[model samples]
Target: MNPAAQEPLDPRDRPARLTVGVVGAGRVGPALAAALRLAGHRPVAVSGVSDASVRRAATLLPDVPVVTPAEVLARAELVLLTVPDDALAALVQGLAETGAVRPGQLLLHTSGRYGTKVLDPALRAGALPLALHPAMTFTGTSVDVQRLAGCSFGVTAPEELRLAAEALVIEMGGEAEWIAEESRPLYHAALALGANHLVTLVAQSMELLRAAGVEAPDRMLGPLLGAALDNALRSGDAALTGPVARGDAGTVAAHVEVLREHAPAAVAGYLAMARTTADRALAHGMLKPEMAEDLLDVLADGDSLGDTRGGAGGGAR
Candidate 1:
C-alpha cells in the first residue's frame, strides 16, 4: 500500500500551499480556482483565449495574472485543465509535446467523460494526474462558487493519488464520489441525461405552453416541475404520474395532437419521452398492459402525426 494514499489532507490547515493555475478560464476553472483560494491556496496564473474568459478570470480571480498556458504551468504547482471534453486530449498532447508539463505537478482536468487515461501523456511527463469533475452545472458566474458548497464531484485517479484528489474536492467544499475509470463515460451520460436533457425538455414545454396562450410559462410550470423533480428524487419509479402513468390513452393521444399542431418540432420529443415514461410505468406496475394498449398505439403513430397536423384541440388550459 502506498503510504501517501492513506494520509488525510487538512482542507484548511495545509501550510504548504500549492500554487494553482487554470489553463482555461471557462466557467469551471475560474470558479474552482476561486473556491480553492477560499481554502487558502494561492491562484498564481490562468489562461483564456476569449474576451469573456479574460473578464471572467479577472472577476473570479482578482489580481491573478492571465498568462499563456505554458507560463501557467511554469508558475504553478497545480494546473487545472478546464477545456471542453473534445479539446482536452489534444491540449494535453500539445502541452507534453512542447515539454511544458512540469514534473511532480498536480495535473487535474475537470472533464467528466474522461478519467486518468486522457492524462497519460501528462503523467508520462512526470505529472500526477487527477480527474475531479464537479457534478453541478456552471452558470459562468460567482454563484457557481457558492453552489460548490454541497456539490458532489466525480473523482477518478490512480490509487496512489486518490487521497490527493479527494482533498482537492473537499477543499473546494464538495463531496468526492469516486468513479471507476471504465465507468466514467456511463457516469457522465447519466448526468447529461438527467441535467442536460432536462433543460431541453423544459424549454420545449415552455414554448408549447406559450403557443397554447399561456403567459409566464416559467411561473406556471415552476411549482409543478419542482414537485415532480422532488417526487422522482424521493420515490424513483414510484413517482410516476400524469396521463401516461394512469394509462389515460385519450389524454395522451390529445397531447400528441396538440404538440403536433401547436409546435411541430416538439412532437418527436414529446412522443419519445411519453413512450419512455409509459415503459417505466409499465415496468414498475404503475401501468397495466391492458390499459396501455391504446396508449402504445398513440405513441407508435407519433411519426405520422407530423404530416397530418390538424387543429389544436387540447392543451394546458
Candidate 2:
C-alpha cells in the first residue's frame, strides 16, 4: 500500500470522513472497514454476534471501537449493516424497535438479495436507506480484501440516498450502477441464480470428476474453466457451444439419462438450465431453428431422457 494512498487527504475522500459504523463484523464488515480506512476515512465503531468476530475486528480495525449495533449507530453518521441476509431485516427492525437510529444518518446493507426495503425501519426513522452490493465473491481472505478494487457494486437507494451510496462505492475503487429499488429483489434473484447457482454447478462437476477417479479436481478444472470463462466474457451470447448449441438431441438425451442414473439429484437443475441454454443458443445463431426445436423437444419431454455426459459447451451466462 502506498503511504499516500493510506491518507484520505484528497477532496474526493469526503465519504471517508463520513463517520461510518459497521455491524455484523464477519467477512464483509472488516473488509469494508479496511477499505474505508485505507481510503482515509474513519471506521468509528463495529459490532458482531460472536467473540470471534469481535476478536477479528480487534486485529484488523485495531483503532476502531467495538460497540453494540446501537452504539455504532449512535456514534456513526453512516451505518453499514453487513449481517447475513436473513438477519439483515431483523437487525434493522431491532434497531428501529429500540429507536436507536439517529435522524439524518445513512443506513446501508451489503445484501444482494435486498435493497433499501430491508432498512424500512431506518427509513421511517428519517435515516436514508441504501443497498451497496459488490458483484463479486468474498472468501474472507486477504487476497479478496485487496481484489475488491475493480469489482462492480450494485447500488440502490431513494434519490436522496443514491449519490452518497454511489460516492461510497466509487471511493472503494469500484464502478457503481444504479438499480431500481423495486427491482432489487428480482435483480438479486438473477444474480443468485447466476453466481450462487454457478457455485453449485461447479461443485457438482467436481463431484462427477471425483467419482470418475480424477485426481485434484481443482487443479484439473481451474485452467479449463478460466479459458471458458474468458471466451464467455469476450463473446457474450456468441460464446455458446457444445451439444445443445449444436442441436444434438441424442447427446441431450444421453445427459438426462446419466443424471437420472448417477446424479439424480442434479437432474432438475440440468434440465432447466439446458432448456434455457438451448434458447440462448438459438438466439445466438449457433443452432439452426430445426435443431433448436429438436433439442428443446428432447429436453422438454419429461419422461424419456436419461442422464449422460453431453458435449462441453462454454457458456457466458
Candidate 3:
C-alpha cells in the first residue's frame, strides 16, 4: 500500500495555499482566480488569447503577469485550466507532451461536462487531477466573485484526492458535492437544461408580450415569474398551476393555436412543455386522468379548439 494512502485527511483542514496559475482568463478563470486570491492563495500567472480575456485578467488579477500557457503551468503549484470545454483535452495533451506539467503539481479544470478523466494526460505526467465546476453562471466581473459564496461545486477526483478537491472548493467559498466520474455528463446536462434553457424561455415570454404590445413586459413578468420560480422550487409538482396543470383542455388548445399564429418559432416548445406539464400533473394527481386524456388529445390534434374565443361548447374533436 502507498504510504500516502494510509494517512486519512481531516475534513476541517484546509489545503495548503499555493501559487495558482490560471490557464485561460475567460469569465470563469479570472473570477475563480480572484476567489482564490481572497482565500490567501497567490495568482502568479494567467494565459489569455483574446483581447477581452487579457483585459479581464488585468482587471481581476492586476499584479499577476499575463504569460504563455507553458509559463503559467511551470510557475505555479496549482494550475487551473479554464479553457472552453472543447479545447480542454487538447490543451492538457499539449501541456503534457511539452513537459510543461510536472509531477506533484495539482491540476484542475472548470468544465462541468467532464470529470478528471479529461485531465488524464496531466495525471499521466504525475500531476494530481481534479474537476471543480462551480454550478453558477459567470459574467466575467467582480460580482461573480461575490456569487461564488454559497454556490455548489460539482467535484470529481480520485478517492485519495477527494479531501484536497473539497478543500479547494471550500476555500473558494463553495460547497463541494461529490459526483461520480461516470455521472458528470448527466449532471452537466441537468444544469444546462435548468439554467441555460431558462434564459431562452424567459426571452421568448418577453418577446411574446412585446409582440402583443404589452407595456413594460419585463415589469409585468418580474413578480409573477419570480414567485412562480420560488414556488416551484419550494413545492415541486404541487406548485404547478395554469391550464395544463388544471387540465383545461380548451385553454391549452387555444394557447397552442395562438402561439402557432403569432410566435411560430415558439410553437413547438410550447406544445412540448404543455404536454410534459400535463403528464406530470396527471402523475402527481394534480390533474385527473380524464382531464389529462383531454389535454393530451388537444395537444396531439393541435387544432382541437375550433373558434374557442368566439364559440361556446367547443367540443374536443
Instruction: Identify the runs in model 1 with alpha carbons over 4 angstroms from their true place.
Output: 1-15, 307-317
Measured against the true structure, the TM-scores of the candidates, in listed sequence, are 0.91, 0.83, 0.89
Best-first order by TM-score: 1, 3, 2
lDDT of 2 by residue, 177-229 (tens): 78887788888888888789889989999998898799899889999888888
| Candidate 1 accuracy as lDDT | 0.87
- Candidate 3 lDDT over 75-114, as tens digits, reads 8878899999999999999999998987777889999999
lDDT scores in order:
0.87, 0.78, 0.86
The Cα error of candidate 2 at residue 238, in Å, is 1.4
The order of the candidates by lDDT, greatest first, is 1, 3, 2
User: Candidate 1's error at 270, in angstroms?
Assistant: 0.4
Residue-wise C-alpha lDDT for candidate 1, range 51-108, written one tens digit per residue: 9999999999999999999999888878999999999999999999998896677899
Measured by TM-score, how close is model 3 to the native structure?
Answer: 0.89
By summed lDDT, which 10 consecutive residues of candidate 1 come out lowest? 308-317
lDDT score for candidate 2 against the true structure? 0.78
